[model samples]
Target: MGNLVGSWRFKEPSTVEECDSTWGSDSESDEPVAEDDSGISDSVSPAESERAPGHSGDTSPQLSDSPESAPKMKRSFYAARDLYKYRHSYPNFKKSRQPNEYRNLRFYLNKIPLVPDGIYIEEILSKWRGDYDKLEHNHTYIQWLFPLREQGLNFYAHELTQDEIKEFQSTREAKRRFLAAYSLMLDFYGIKLLDKSGNVARASNWQERFQHLNESHHNYLRITRILKSLGELGYEAFKAPLVRLFLEESLCHNTLPNMQHSVLEYYVYTIRLPATRRRLLRYARKHYRPAHAFLWGPPLKRRGGGVGPEGGVGAGSSGIRAPAPTPEQQRRGEDSPSSPSASSRIIVSSHNAMMCQDLAGGGHKGYAGLGSSMVGLEGTILMAGAQRDRNEYNEIVPL
Candidate 1:
């Protein structure tokens, strides 16, 4: 797969001449050398050296070209030791090596193509979080996730450890959050984890679950979080329902202003239809009079205010919150009328919503898609236009 080149230093094996010069005695031997005593023997191993621990004997001689021939010089490194070399550049081989001082290192490296299996290798390695226990080491940590292929389903499974499941099973809130998050993950990434039942059941009914949450005043934040994730995943199907939730102030009226604002924001940034924009602006102005306090005021009616249904504005907020969109509403959003003029208007409105963010200047009172008769309602009349400045306030006339 790759080519590397570098010079290496290796120790030379000792021959009879080297041994006689290095280990000879001053006295001559009375006996002559034996005919078969060629002075060649097997090299001692590290284990054998350990057995004779205290002896100051020299280590085995460096491997030589032949058993009978001595080498030119003694070398420090081994002759057959495997080595590693990082090829900084190719073609100009010698100059690109790390350095001569780092030659003949006892390390090994593997070379792989920058692209493998038609995908960039870097992308595959990106999932490796390295190691958690050893922060300083460079060991790659792998999650036990695998792509499951069965029947007609093919999705990744996020495997959890026993300890993780134990902790998760103990906390009720954790289960709810995990289920909500798992619903999002299943919808977006085609990934799922085993539920409490340890079944591979798909979260097919997220809408109903969140709608039940809509009835609860306490779980509104979780519902909003789920909606936010859906919106980010570009699930355009949730637009009308999110808008419905946004207007259901009574459903989340008991929640904190921050939670309500998040819901409002998630829907506003998501639903891009021109009709939805008009509806949102009208509802925000009438019901949420403290526009400046919530950081959103009523958008001014462009050119003409003949956008919504002909009805009274204040009549709707009868302490009864609106419900999620019906099947018909969802169907309409999927197949709505779009004209060039309407698209241009939507673009303009979107630009305005982005720019007209300074709600602190003043509040603009809006009607809740109703006629002048709504202003006369006992519940909404006093609250109507209450956030509007007193100096320029005037009686709202019915159309």
Candidate 2:
């Protein structure tokens, strides 16, 4: 506010050589201008006049432009080159998610706590890649291969190429051949393969089969076959070793009966043993005991001249006879009157008598009584004796 137009302070002027040298300039001074004229000259040449049409005569402003600006141009050129190179190098990169897919597969394969899906895929892929063409005619091999191919395609999705699909299909066929060959070898050597299914396929000639296996092979025919058989039967064949270990412990420790039952049921179902036969035999023996008494034991003799322990009783031989009670014994004669002041009386008669009522309630009938007449006779006599005593004035009587 005090001096909007300040005084122009000037430093001592330096020579052109001194200015060039101080500023590290390499240009040699070919033309010199008078310093007192403020670097402006009135001398004009024909060549300068001719250039004035294109030039603005603003040379003093050119001092602001320096070599530092050259770097900006260079940087721009390099940046353009890098962009071009990147575009050329990855023309179809955006179309394929191969990198992500591969990365994800590797991550899951490495990070999974249990058997990774990638392992199975890799196995199938490797096998298919080996010699798939040969397996085209194998129905069983094809049956197994198609499902695996579908699974791989579904899993990898857009990441895999047509070529890769073909290769994978081939690899599956190769794996089938490998498995079959391996299985045959195990069979030749009398080995067996275990699989998830609780089924067993024995290699009758395992020794010969062993010779065909190599370091690259999965070489688990016996175990895999066993597992496959077990799996087919819906058992946990993969856990067979653990099951066996537990069973061994139970047998050695003499654990509870229930432990044995569990082991038996598992073994019967998993191993397909003859457990049901033993169980049926046990049940049959239990029910057979009562039948044995009537048909084979001493109770057979009570049925009257029936078959003896050795053979049927001779027709001529008389069996033991049961005695029958006499009429006086049956009536159980009443006590004589005046002997001990006793009187005879009928407890039950046609009148005021309780007739046996049939369960069907058709009419009054003789008592059915329990068992044979011999058992009933004993009960009736006791009733008669009590009635005779009651009639003698000892007590009131009723039939």
| Per-model TM against the reference | 0.22, 0.15
lDDT of 1 by residue, 1-399 (tens): 133222332233233122121102211222322211111111111111111111010221222233122211111111101000000001121111222221111000012211112222233333322222221121121111110000001111122222233333455644453344333333321223344432332235544433433333323323332333332222334445445544554223532232343344333433333344345545554555322222232222333431222332111111111223467755764475531222232211211111121221222232121222121233243333332322211111100
**RMSD for each of the candidates:** 36.8, 51.1
What's model 2's TM-score? 0.15
Residues forming the 10-long window of minimal summed lDDT in candidate 1: 80-89
lDDT of 2: 0.26
Write model 2 residue lDDT over 360-382, tens digit each, in one string: 23233333221122133343564
